[model samples]
Target chain A: MGYEEAFPPADMKWAGNAAKRFASPFVDVPHDRIDVDAIILSHAAVASGYTIRDFYEKPELGIHCVAYASAMYDLLPVTHWFFSLPWVTELGIRLEYKDTLPPIPAAGQEHVLKDPSDVDKIHVPDKNELDKGWTLPMFKRLYTYVQKNLGHTLVPISYGFDLVGAAAELCGVENFIMWTFTEEEAAKKLVRKYTETAVNGAEGLADTFGSAMLIVGSVLGNNDIFSDEAVKMYSADNMKYYVNQCFRKGAGPQVFYHLCGNHETDYKVFKDTLMWSPFTVIHAGYKARDPFPSALLKSEFQDRATCMGSVDTKLMIAPNPKAVYDQAKKQLLEGRDSKRGYILGTSCETPPYTIPGNIYALTRAARDFGTYGTW
Target chain B: MEVIMSDAVKELIGKRGLKVADVEEVVKNGKAIQKKGTNHYIASKMIGDVTAYAEYDLESGILKKKANVTSAYSHRIKLIKVDKLDEVSDYVMGSTPVHNATLQMEYMTVVRSGPGLATADGSVLMVEEYLATKTLAVAEGLFEKKRA
Candidate 1:
């Protein structure tokens, strides 16, 4: 059940060295000791009845590995800003205007779209304009490094883009809701502008990376914060537009869509919008009260795409290690029989405070019970 | 000088044994200072040897409280009065208290205005800075009561 038992020390050492060489500074563990890929696979194999080789052979798994690397290297600067504005304390990033404001300022003070009438002010930055700073060069260096060193084992992907979520960032959440109600036309225009920007950015990255799997990290389009009617009316169309734009003329690479938060009533919207698209993998978070059963995935999305995730993030922080193992084991056991290949992962981001022992426990459970014929 | 008195102001003035006419004489030529909230206004003046600080509710013209201090506590005591005005402004600008007589319940409701803790029901809990800024706006007469 231990990490070494699941992954040979040699494989762990190799992955650790790869992580250290490319991931430095960002990943806290020592260069020769960082083995996130082995950790992911050693645990994943236990749940999916697949060997490490079997996992890597699948392009989807490669995409996930690239997504993790992109995150570790901070390839997506936009996503980092999303985290920094709200949870800077948790991430230990200092705020620039801390002195002028009180100890903590309001969340939306940095919002750009203060007025609905100013939607026209939003502009999609050209590639050169976006590259004027370190983000572009750093991303290029990391992407090139990942593609060169880990390309054979894992695909190099951008953690991906989020149109609606980025729009929420530019337009304060309150103003976003206000505009949706009071100025529907302006809101639609804003969404269109951002969606086009997102598509352009994705295409640009895809061209640079030469075929990378992209992840939309937080399809805020599926968030319950907006009313069901509003989501149906506004968000649904925007998402459909994004999908169409990304796939049109082969503008971007294949996509893996990730959505968080309570979406009990809204999953149908995603299903309906994306049902026909061949360029997506849907990873949804779990609703603790109504866990996403494998049968539901089979019945609802079997023909369209593979489904991943729904392991409760709460288990990652549970007091007892056994709780984490038990939860991971239960999820794997259910997913072992799934016709659509299930990739076991936390329903949401593993919280910053989740302990290493709990993470190891997840892999331990997978290794112990994830044999091909065990189910 | 225009003097307005709330119930609390009358009590403080009566307890201190200061005449309203004397406080008004100083306030008439005082410098006006504002705080965070719309209703909070303070007027400070030095008359001969005594410095008088008067806190006023801008909306209703009610003098919430007044303090008179000799050179020693003049600055410190005036700050104290302004702080009191901030508290009153928070209560006034915050959501109105909801009371259910049938259930014998009473509680004030506040929207989650900034980044902080949130309740299970998704109500954002108030952060200290947000509370300070919001209440100060009310005290400074910068807050306008929104028409419901």
Candidate 2:
């Protein structure tokens, strides 16, 4: 199983509803005859109003299956892996980089960022092209480096989930929402086109560099833009259509649907549309209205879907380490009782304001209370 | 969950020098436990000038009865502790000093908001003492302008 892309393709009108389009990789990998079990699609959609069918042109690709794979090497030095492995055929790597959008100008010659929230972490104008032109070459470079260096661990180099909210920032919220209802056909065409461009780029890179796995993500689940009704009506069908097309294509890459928002109502729709049976992982803040009551979601999904994210991120920033620890403990206990897969994570991004002591508490709870079994 | 009086509460009662007999009648007469959600908020209310009771059955415990305060109200019991005599007396006596301290603190931390502060709506609130003082000052000609 592979995890879905957390990021989304720029200009996807219903990117917030992209979670609904999630397809499990386990289903598609066998169809595509790929030995790899998982894949990720960084945020690249097809042309306006076009479906995933239009992108891959075949129906065998598993572009919507979501699952999680190991990232054992992401935190380690790439050079070390190059020198160590001699028996493997290819190198697998996960690439993540910050965005570079120019700060909004307050006055002439003085650039002022509206929110001093992520002042230190963000830079200007280094964003992934929404056009999906550069991602292919980037993958090629990464794969080539891996193959030329040691030719080991080269299986599935999941690309990324790009800057979560970057696309919304590029094309303001109101315009994006209006595009969904007013220009539905055009929007679908654009998604299909962009998605194809990205897949083409990914495929070209894969063939050239001798890589297998494809990974992608960005913020497609944030609820600040479209409402649930609009998503269900316009976005859900398109997501399903695209995922179906990916299945038709012979792309061995598994699909992953990732996002970072509190979209509780869309869970059923996401599961239905993505068809995440037997394989895949759904990682987000599944904040049920009643935590004690909704503990069953963990058991119901089992290995098919793993709910991630730590207790609310606000706990740590509240200067309450105990709150963080307690939340983790509660989630693990809930997971154990429900017989479902649970991953320790934050509800959202690990903000710079977060205290390091509270962050470490997550590890402590996992160590103290974790066990290996469903629930 | 069983509710047990904490050691801090016991020490507090001891510090107040209250005995079980002091609240014997209140405990006997104070029926009906205040149902706070699922838990009981057992408390008692004083009816007469009696500050102490004759005797209390520590084993049988306080009697329980239906609440009769108001038709629309929920059931709530008036809790009577062996140490409530000192608690109530100290509470009533402490009020005057607390108010005095608050007044002193107000003077020390005065804010100038045009001599008035509005609430949620644009309605000004004037302190009753300030209003009375101002009215008296005007009656006594204390606020009158002198001849230039």
Candidate 3:
């Protein structure tokens, strides 16, 4: 209902468990169970029986719902929506909120940048604009409350470190892709602008948030957009500059890579390139539309980083509980024995409208198969 | 969910320079409409940039089943992943016509220690054969002692 009801300041047991659950893969904190860090968005409402409109209008409800639903379903982690919206908001993207859904990009919000030279189209957000929404002022307050009162870190960047995708979003996709070859220097300047904003903005608030988790949701870095050659020789090469800079600059305490689309060609390029934080968890999304199996991730990544296996959002949205349970079981069995540790997660955000039974199915699968040493 | 990888299947993956992750992608993304009759599903995927389709049914990088051959690669020399870096390093050192053994080690040190994915530990690699070939010779000319 409000920040006071969001997370209890006295709940050290809950706080410690939640902290260890997320920190387990990277640290020896003794949390060995397989669980979900679903990045549950408005979908937090889907699990808690609240309307999506309520989550956005009163994000504390979303926070409460996350805790409520996570406990209800025995899910081990929770995420907030504030980490994402400001990226679009800073781009002058208008959002139209609805009664039953999170805000969507308003119609007629044209791509803001006309060319690579239109570098002035975006700017680094100041602390005030960090919550630039009719209702978003609450996030700044809630996050501050969470950290100071609850002793927890709140920010995990979703779309940060994605220099290529962020730049493309500003200009149109085709224009940005063409300029990578035709106007290379100008394009790099444009990408560097967004990269600096993402990195520096976090750095500026380092004392407040304690640590920024630089998560790279390189959505546009998917194989469909560029050849393995061009992506390797170009896109990934360009973005790695910022990635190295993120590490070299000490932008965060950890880095999470959510390669959000088909990466069959792109992963090879990334596998041998790019820096990873010790707490790195790479959750590569579906290929074409199928979830990237966890077994492949283990073979490919070894113990270099924790590999998270995902259940498709599509399957979760369906009413078929058995399918969700089966898929979750498959992913849990495959990844539960990973040498570097494994997490069962949704491919992206668990869709806000996903049916309740399907959401419960993930918890059921975890109990049946994800308990440590069973595999 | 069940796609078997025999030794021959693994070799097909290795020779092409791909990883198990790539095959998982191909299989999962595919309709897997069991061929009208065959056990092998014709796994197809859309290629990057270029309007084309590429098939990627690579084996998982782990060599659980023994193989007569080892190394894994991608075009222009990127390692998808390798079972034994020593085996691949030996081939590059003893064979590759680019340079002599001494020069090769010097070059590889520079490569592994440099930047990007191929860290000194050598779990996964980013090999640059063509570029390194030219660079190695340049280094040799600049540093190697002239025979009296």
Candidate 4:
């Protein structure tokens, strides 16, 4: 194989934007002089994608830039790679970060009919006033703008799988779970509401970006926030409902599902979902004492899908490069036996604070052990 | 802003959803009523205004109050202060006050950690189970009073 790509392209201006939005304390590389093989356009405003394109277009520093778009499954900022077309290489989304979040659409542009039963459960206080149906058009505008101005692929976003957290946020976690057992009818109706909106959004993306894939997104692993019962009731069936209705019917681009937790329990949900075997599974962590081996997924879906990084971002910040190198080696060795489609990467988003030498070490490990033959 | 009630008085006040102040009013009723220490053998006159009271019963499980209805009664009936909010919360099983009534209660204990109740200190509560027949009797009497 060849050398694997290092994200946070050296030339891109993420620092200034990071500081502007996140109030990052450290200075980032100047956008004009940054260098990178590709760009993972995080889930943010329009300027993020443009900044990456401009870096590559500069006459002084030429590089190949791929626009990795975030999904719209929830309010969080995370990307989902939903295209199989050769022009858009699919790099899976991260669970720890945010997703592409556009402000709720303006009201009256389109009628967002609510299922009769879900009228009371819709949290947006004035549901009729929000532009629920116009997400597709706005996205189309974003795609058209990016493609025309920057010449990048209009990857249809696979958004809106963070329903578990969304539900918990709207209703406290204890009450949400309590509602399922106590208020059975109301709970079922709420789940149906969440699933239906997601399906509608999926149809919108598919309709706009015809050659696009669906990304089932989730933040299922926040202190077991995706409680077993919550997962069984809300996540499992709702995902099946949306994917079958919206994603499965679409043409072009194999669908991908992105999860942000260790996913210790939902592995079954991941393997069995109707979407195309994922193009990439990002951020499944590897712990030293996890009862089962990390290699288990390799045996199961390695041939069917691509496995992204497994090196824990926390482990990479060790004082020396050797520790980073050692951990990366361990991950490759564990994964090498499966030897199908493998992309050596961190178990979660590579934190910006990661040491550069360690980042280089990861690139080296992917080159060294990410190959098909003997390590 | 203080509300206090004994286990027996609180139960007479009903459990659906009542504040301490509401229970306190019932204990200090002006009408002549049977009072046995913390227990009130009979509370002939419901103390709080109808609007302030969430219709509920002290027995027949907490689930009985899931519905709402209103009835005017001119006469008062007898009630035994079998248990109060503190004693009921103590014996109610499971994680919540509602769950306690649903689950078995042989080994249940009252919440006693003073620092835990964010609203105040010394805010411990209890729960207790009456004899099986009295369970239904108390529930019947509470709803009976609702009609009167």
Candidate 5:
């Protein structure tokens, strides 16, 4: 396959604006628009009539989907590919795929790490060996595609599947949760194993793409789905401590905390420990399905983090773009003056078939109501 | 100007978000009432007025730092004395306390860490979180009676 494909000139004014927002969020630079990301992937594929299977199987199509969707919707702070299977599939778990559905681990599939003791099997793929896998080659092509075609410095973000949360999927999720309470020693040992994979994976991608905004997400391991006591026993208390080891191993300056769960119970765990990067954007998910109050996030994290506003993902699927616009405007109003910084985003990934009008409305609201302030 | 807190107490306190700065300020300036006869001192209620019953070595009339300043009550209830604020945080965090006992005896540990008082009915609490379970009015009352 020829590595080069023909493309037209892309509008990159949004990239420059986003770069300024990232570099000096609070500096009084003349930025008229705040950065907005729609998590616009599945919709991009749909625009091209390419299914979820094609995006993963055709590695080259991954960048094309992100590019087409980001440009189609004028999404800022452009991202390359985003999917969870590239991570889970490597664990020897069987995956079920369809035209409409993203690759998901098959139900009742035997977990590769069937027991906590099997944690010893999780070897971190060294830096050199990373590209031999499916994820890195796509990353190489993405960076090359961005630089070669657009002459733009695309900051491809790290994949969002956090190590500790992904580790549970490696060993059946239920089994791992039970082990945290019943077999404490074994669970912590597994944590170290997953931390290595996570750090090595980030190091590998950054090596491939030069630099990236490391998105360390810890959601499936949060207290809402898990118990508060167990979260302390393992996820919050242990995962955070081990993940910080990435800094010592050499990571990028920016870290995006995809804290995508109801954090009412364990917010302190993150407030106290999770943030280690100089440039941090903390994405708050929800408190009981409604958007976690942006004001509360601002209050707790504004001193140290750029709080991302959670425009509800359900709104993205709403027939009317006005619903998405109103939600984005509400988030912008409360989150705009966050002392540290603010970026508007959906509560999480916008569902696959989310209408394009809703995506554009999100950006329109961002420009209409976004903070027009110093850098 | 002279507050003598043992290194163990200092280390334990550090775990509860008390920096050396806060401890020095509270110890030097905060009122420390000696726990009756024990060398330990109960400093003025701090940290949301939860009343950290600092286990301290009392020097004459001065408040000196010690550990488990509440052995005074755990002394009576047959519960092990837990004067360390870290243990208070641990217990609040659902950690098994130093001494395992029946639920009744467990509640008996209602924080004898000096500043706290275990009531006749065994209902008082000192950890900041437990204080919020009551109404604002009742919470303020609990706050007032938090320190014996």
Candidate 6:
């Protein structure tokens, strides 16, 4: 069957509901065609909201695209085959799958960089090389296929490289931590190399797709893993460079940085780095200690950059849909007074098994409490 | 589908010097031997050459479970081991002491006159002391009892 036949667009009933409630741009459903379960779940989620006859009936939801094709290659079985290929294996990078957990990048028990000097071994594949590689090809195939099918209905979000995360994957968390302290020079060099490559790659994707927003996933830059000082010195510094490069390359003005952990201490670094940048959005992931992102929006970023997310993933799993609605209400109320825009979403990716009821409650709460000018 | 460990359980395993992978392997391969609570289940099986246990709380979405059994077993040795010499030294030192020497079986080192004691070995004295603590924890309802 054709891809479109296998995974049909959102149900007309649900689409219509979503369209009535939400503005032109609505919440972008992640991976609505991965399987039968996804299709059913996506329909349920859409039905729960005000929908439009077509996916592109409104442009307000901005550009809705699934970039997971590139970011989460480890989840696919094809990745294992790609890793086993002689050509890919020669690069000294292998995909490590443990039971059912997401695949990790490793060089045997150690990372590609055993020591500081091994920074030279760190290879940031150029665009041509990446296009020829196995994983990227698979990602491109999925992206292109989705674009070809859904492009008319939805804006396609292309993939952008995550430099901080890519560095951690290459060096391994342990070695990366050690290098930060003991081998600062080599660590910095490696980070710089990765940062430059990521900037160029992201710019290229932006140029190709003409996407409205370029999302840079930098979960490793959170304060949970690094001290506030280190976050500024490393993550913040590189982010500044990234934003500058994107603008320089005319990769659209809006840049959304996805940092998916606790960043109470390092949040300021983000503010300082991107507050002045053009049309920035901070996709703050959920933190158990602080379940609200309104403080971030209302603060120094009040008039600057949009803030997205703060809903705890745990709440989505709560048996009571009211719990999800309550949290969503709280998030909306907190951001009500902010001059900056706020987008309601889960702190991170919605778990594949998230109940349809809870997903419905989220959009329901957004419609109930997220009304513009409704305090 | 495999159960994902909660952050609390992950932190517990890290503190106990066990890899999350070890506990995950047991959970994936082990048979369900018992139920602990409404959402929790206990699985037991032999993984590779070692017997393994996993406690999973399934209510929290597809992921999110408490692996108490893995955390318990991973720290079994450290939890059971006690240092009688350090206890003796603490008693001898009382509130004040210039210096004191005591043997720590766990660390395989002699504790020589210090405010705090450090041991590198896994051996300890009076296994009952450890058992008492476990009993206390169980009595305190830290872990759920097996369903009847």
Q: Per-residue lDDT tens digits of candidate 4, residues B1-148?
A: 1223356544544544444454434333412212123212221134443222222222232434111111112111122121112112221112222111111111011100000001012122111112111222222332332222
- lDDT winner: 5
Candidate 5: where is the Cα deviation over 4 Å? A1-7, A13-18, A21-30, A94-96, A106-109, A150-153, A237-243, A371-375, B1-148
Task: For model 5, give the TM-score of chain B.
Answer: 0.36
Tell me the alpha-carbon RMSD of every candidate: 26.6, 29.6, 19.3, 24.3, 14.6, 27.2
Give the range where candidate 4 chain A is weakest over 10 consecutive residues by summed lDDT: A84-93
Error of 2 at B110 (Å): 73
By TM-score, the best candidate is 5
CA lDDT, every prediction?
0.43, 0.32, 0.55, 0.36, 0.57, 0.46
> Predictions ranked by TM-score, top down?
5, 3, 6, 1, 4, 2
Q: What TM-scores result for chain A when each predicted structure is judged separately against the true chain A?
A: 0.68, 0.54, 0.83, 0.60, 0.87, 0.74
- Assess the local accuracy of residue A59 in candidate 4 as a C-alpha lDDT between 0 and 100: 11
Q: Better model by DockQ, 1 or 5?
A: 5
Q: Give the chain B TM-score for each candidate.
A: 0.36, 0.23, 0.29, 0.22, 0.36, 0.38
- A292: Cα error in model 4, Å: 9.2
Residues A1-375 of candidate 2: C-alpha lDDT, one tens digit per residue? 211232232222222122211111211211111011111111111212223332122111112211111121011011110111110111111122212211221123321222223222222211133213334443444445434432322333433332222222223334444555665554444333334333443445434533233233323533444556544444444444333333222222233344445555655555444423112345545444322212544643443444443467566567878887888777666653322234555564344345656756665665566533322
lDDT winner, 1 or 3: 3
Fraction of native Cα-Cα interface contacts (under 8 Å, chains A and B) also present in model 2: 0.00
Task: Write the residue-wise lDDT of candidate 2 on B1-148 in tens digits.
Answer: 1123345543433443434333333344643232223222222324342222111112222564322111111101111111101111111111221010000001111111111111222121111212112211221121111100
Question: Candidate 2's C-alpha lDDT?
Answer: 0.32
Comparing 1 with 6 on lDDT, the higher-scoring candidate is 6
lDDT of 4 by residue, A280-359 (tens): 33334433323123377676555434444366666555668777677776666666454324445555544433455666
Instruction: Please compute DockQ, using alpha carbons, for every candidate against the native two-chain complex.
Output: 0.01, 0.00, 0.01, 0.01, 0.01, 0.01
What would the per-residue lDDT of candidate 3 be over residues A142-169, giving only the tens digit for each residue? 5565455433435533236456766666
Docking quality category of candidate 6 according to DockQ thresholds: incorrect
User: What tens-digit string does per-residue lDDT give for candidate 1 at A148-222?
Assistant: 444433343443355555565566656776777898888878767766655555455555754444455445655
What is the clash count of model 2?
A: 89
Q: lDDT of candidate 4?
A: 0.36
Task: Output the better candidate (3/4) by DockQ.
Answer: 3
